[model samples]
Target: MFALEIENLSFTYPDLTPALEDVSLQIKRKKKTAILGANGSGKTTLIYHLNGIIPAQQGRVKVLGQQVDKKNMQEVRKAVGLLFDNPDNQLFSTTVFNDIAFGPRNLKLDPDTMTRRVQEALERVGIRELAERPPYCLSLGQKKRAAIAGLLAMKPRVLAFDEPFSGLDPEVADQFREILDELVEEGATLVFSTHDVNLAYGWADEVVIMKAGRVLTAGTYDLLRDGQVLKEAALPLPLLAQLFRNSHEQPRTVEEAAALVEPGSGRLKAVDSSR
Candidate 1:
């Protein structure tokens, strides 16, 4: 089952340049899909159509078997939860718990079940201690977690994120990665956008590159290893890809590279660690 199936989808804002043109693709279910593109590449515009945030101007969008239209807009939204680039846009309740509860509350689940889900979501995202804190007083990382908790409470089939790690510090990003790793391992279907080729290489099971409102390419994560594709999208090859350009043994992550560079493997001597 595909997490998303989009066909001939096109959208253009009034008096603005086209944001998406003839886009068509299917994201695999229960896997990490990363859309890579520079600014103005329409990555954000595309995911918005996955939910009902941006109405379809041309073709079709289906989320987890439910066709997206005015009739099934709510169902499509319920199937796919979007995590915005900015936490401020999603968090409105005074306390973090209430902010997270907002989505589940709308579902009208029995009060006991709603409370259980809300608390479980908070614990899953590691924000239970901050549940009573005012969202405005929390740190940015905390706010992001709170926002994600809100989506988790809804239990959507697919979770879409515009730019999950855009503004986070290195330490915070590391922490965020841990949470995402757990989710992905538990078979949570995710579609997230990022301009960071390294992040896409390390995190995504599938990669989709966009350029000027068009899909430049889409395939397995190894597709990012192709310098030509990245070059066309004005992106560089991932750091690991660059490091192993001439090598037959390609390592996608630091852990893999380190394992391949064991005592006297000779591979370690050729690499310039300074990079």
Candidate 2:
């Protein structure tokens, strides 16, 4: 069975319009999945369903073979760690260390174990040096990492990140990507949402595109590239894919695309240089 599953799940706010409509999908265990779409496309809504924060009124949502419902919320919470788009929404303690330790505390882990988990989590995000800083005192990127550390301390099997790289400089974004890759490598299932197609292509093993509160497409990187789902979703293709569109050969990387597009001897020279 898939690690996480959503079947015809739909959600609507009391007064606002529908946030998600009959959306269904599955995430394999330990696979890194990226949810891509334009803003207000219900990407965040879908992740919330996985964690039981937004209960499905129309269809079923499951995690690890168990359906998400009030009765199983405790189990579901332990299984899924949700990182909100805004770090402020996730971080809630006088100091960074307390914030990171909160999850383990709720789980009733002993003080010794909680301390170890907090330290490991902070180190994992490379924020160990900021352990005592106030949440409001840290930089935006630091807060993001600390927020993630808080979730990591819980040691959840699945992590749902909403717009993780929303507002970071290039260097910090790269660091965030590395942290995510490490978590996936360590067998954590990652479901992250972002509109940045460039990062989505490079980072995700599979892409699920959402539009108008429903899934428009779901596939591997090559499948997404072959189909014009991006255009249909009102999203841009990855830059390299955009450059190589309709070309006889498809290039997976920008350097490869440069080699493919450059003329004759120059193309050969570019390939050699990349090599």
Candidate 3:
């Protein structure tokens, strides 16, 4: 079964400001999906429907074959964990360990299992040493990790993140990527929204581009090279794709881009030497 299925989904705030309109897509099970869009493009709104955070105002949203509705929300939430863009929004307990333990505690897990789950989550996010630290004192990156540890403690099958890399330094982002990779390896379906076109191009197995509350297109990283779609979404072509487009080489990653410009046996090297 698809991890998530949305058909003709639509949503609007109480003031009638449209957040999503006639959106439709299917996210494959256990795959990495990237939702790319500019701010206010409905990426957050769409994910909210997956777990019934924002009830479907119109159309259907199904998670793992169960339709999303008020009655099913608790079940859906247990299966899907969402990490908001701001770590502050998710971390509330005095200590990092308490924050991580909060979810499993809600599930009424025994003390021993709860402790084990919290520790496992802390280790998974590489934040075990921060267990005793207050959430208020942690760095933004540390808080982000602690927040993710909370979701990990829930043991959800589907994970959603909103602008997870925002405000993170390159080193922290790389570490976050490793955590995401580990989750995927463990068979979790990961869906994340990002404005970083390069990150989506390099990391996502499938891409969905949105604009003004609607999906402009959905496809593989190859979509990154489509100027028309990028233009419609107000997104620039990924730098690697733009630089290699005319050369018949479409490198999807930095490693591939490096190889494409290698000192010998690469046309780019000769071009560079001329300058």
Put down candidate 3 lDDT per residue, 23-88, tens digits, no spaces.
999999888999999999999988778788888989999999999888977899999999898889
What is candidate 1's TM-score against the reference? 0.94
For residues 1-275, could you state the per-residue lDDT of candidate 2 as single tens digits? Answer: 78899999989989968899999999888888899989999998898888999888999999999999999999999999998999999888999999998889998999999999999999999998899999998989999999999999988999999999999998999899888888889989999999988887766888899999999888876655744778889887787666556555666656666666547555433233322
Q: On residues 118-156, what C-alpha lDDT tens digit does candidate 1 reach at each position?
A: 999999888889989999988888889999999989988
C-alpha-based local distance difference test score of model 2? 0.87
TM-score (C-alpha) between model 2 and the true structure: 0.92
Model 3 ranges with Cα > 4 A deviation: 264-266, 269-275
TM-score of each: 0.94, 0.92, 0.95
lDDT of each: 0.89, 0.87, 0.90
Better of 1 and 3 by TM-score: 3
Q: After superposing candidate 1, which stretches have Cα over 4 Å from the reference?
A: 262-275
**Model 2 residue 34 distance off true place after TM-score fit, in angstroms:** 1.1
RMSD of each: 2.9, 3.4, 2.7
Model 3 worst lDDT window (10 residues):
266-275
lDDT of 2 at 100: 96
Answer with 1 or 2, whichever has the higher lDDT.
Answer: 1
